[model samples]
Target: MTQESSRTPPVQDQAAPVSGEGAQAFTRAQVEELFLNAAREGDADLLTRFLAAGMDPNLRAEKGYTPLILATYNGHAQAAAVLLAHGAQPDLQDEKGATALAGVAFKGDVALARQLLDAGASVDVPNAVGRTPLMFAVMFGREPMARLLLEAGASPTLRDGEGLSAVDLAQRQGNTALAQDIRHAAQG
Candidate 1:
């Protein structure tokens, strides 16, 4: 058995005292703030320790952004990975219906976007305005992010509330190359 397995105690204790507080729990808002800070600071070690200490991995901020979403938005790939491993839902959306993938795409962080996708983030999840990650990437002129989202199964043909597809948004932004790429993805 590995060291970690060896440290596992046999299930015999009837009632071991809970390590931290017993019945008195912090309010959901306070817990959310703590997790949000951990995510925003990119403190993977602190986040992991918090999770290990019985903190909920799915805790969300006031705006409905979970720790995983905030971590990805802040470019904390390691924190995001740790959260995912600890049962953070990759497809959870914020108040605006924007997923972590969409946040990373808007920031033009192709690597982070790839990481989110690999962690099971939805490429086609639409925001409040029916804008997918691809649409956000195109609208923001993030060509690299747009290409990455396309490769990861984002549909260029999906239209937003404005009746504009990702390609259309790219064209509106005057990004001809990105528009071309979106068109090619739609063709495929």
Candidate 2:
């Protein structure tokens, strides 16, 4: 059969094209290791110095975890906040598609989750299995995070690849109360 008329798909003429290579070039393993160390140690001054020296605030390790993610995971809230102020992509996902918000949510750190949210993380960005931050919060029975995500406009009805919604995940995790709360938020 004759091929359909050859036509280029419409490119979204929106934001400027991101220079992936240029961005990736600045993110070296050595810098990431140092940054992660500083974050783990909660050395805000050192972390700031490194960022000032042109080290990417969102540099990801081979495991796909970013500095912001590691900082929050390690309970370095201030460091994570500093990184956000330095242009770190709060929504940057690891190799497993887990964003900083998802990481903090799993840890039940409501404050860090809020920081990531305020930093402009997308509440709807799903992980590799389609689990959003809200899903993680609900699954972990983090009531505060669930409420925060709801207040931040997270959709409780959003489903993962397996058709599991946030409420469903909460129920599966034996959190009936959270499932009810999510349902209410979704309705609102």
Candidate 3:
């Protein structure tokens, strides 16, 4: 896409608005680009407007990244809140089979993870490799996130495609103590 072509079409004219040109109407590509940019930038107000105007909250990008995924992955709590309130599916997976909850756990955004959990996202939701949010958190040394997931009922004993549970992954990442902590937490 050219730089000049990347700009959104004018929302309106000062007086007489052109036909088929306004806030509610847009080409499919323009709508996709607009939503992707808005979500990525955490533009809550813009997202509210787009959603109010009947934009699909779950529209996915070429990589199967929905607006909710982008907003949460980019750490936009308000933007993500708006999308979720507008009916964005919290469990919608990207092309890599990563859900919003799993992404937030990997990114270590506990607040975002809580929001997703409240939105009914599965705590044990897995990626393509069957690595749950707990596994991602433990593997990346996100103790706070791992704790939250464990509290949310994420299965520490669940294994990934490589047969690594949260504890196993922590150990592989050289966090033997973290692995033990995960084990202890799961037990108690």
In angstroms, the error of model 2 at 115 is 1.1
- TM-score, each model? 0.83, 0.80, 0.85
List, residue by residue over 1-188, the lDDT tens digit for candidate 1.
44533222122223332234333234445544666798888889878867886778887677888898889889998998899999988888899999888898889999888887887788899999999988888888888888888888888898989898887888889998888887887787
Runs in model 3 deviating more than 4 A are 1-25
Q: Which prediction has more favorable lDDT, 1 or 2? A: 1
Q: Judged by TM-score, which candidate is best? A: 3
The TM-score measured for candidate 2 stands at: 0.80
Note the clash tally of each candidate. Answer: 0, 0, 0
Arranged by lDDT, best first:
3, 1, 2
lDDT of each: 0.80, 0.78, 0.84
lDDT of 2 by residue, 1-188 (tens): 11221111112233433234323222244445666788767777778877776777877676888888888888888898788889989888999999888888888888888888888889888998999988888877788988888999999999998999998898898888888988888777
**Backbone clash tally (model 3):** 0
Off by over 4 Å in 2: 1-31
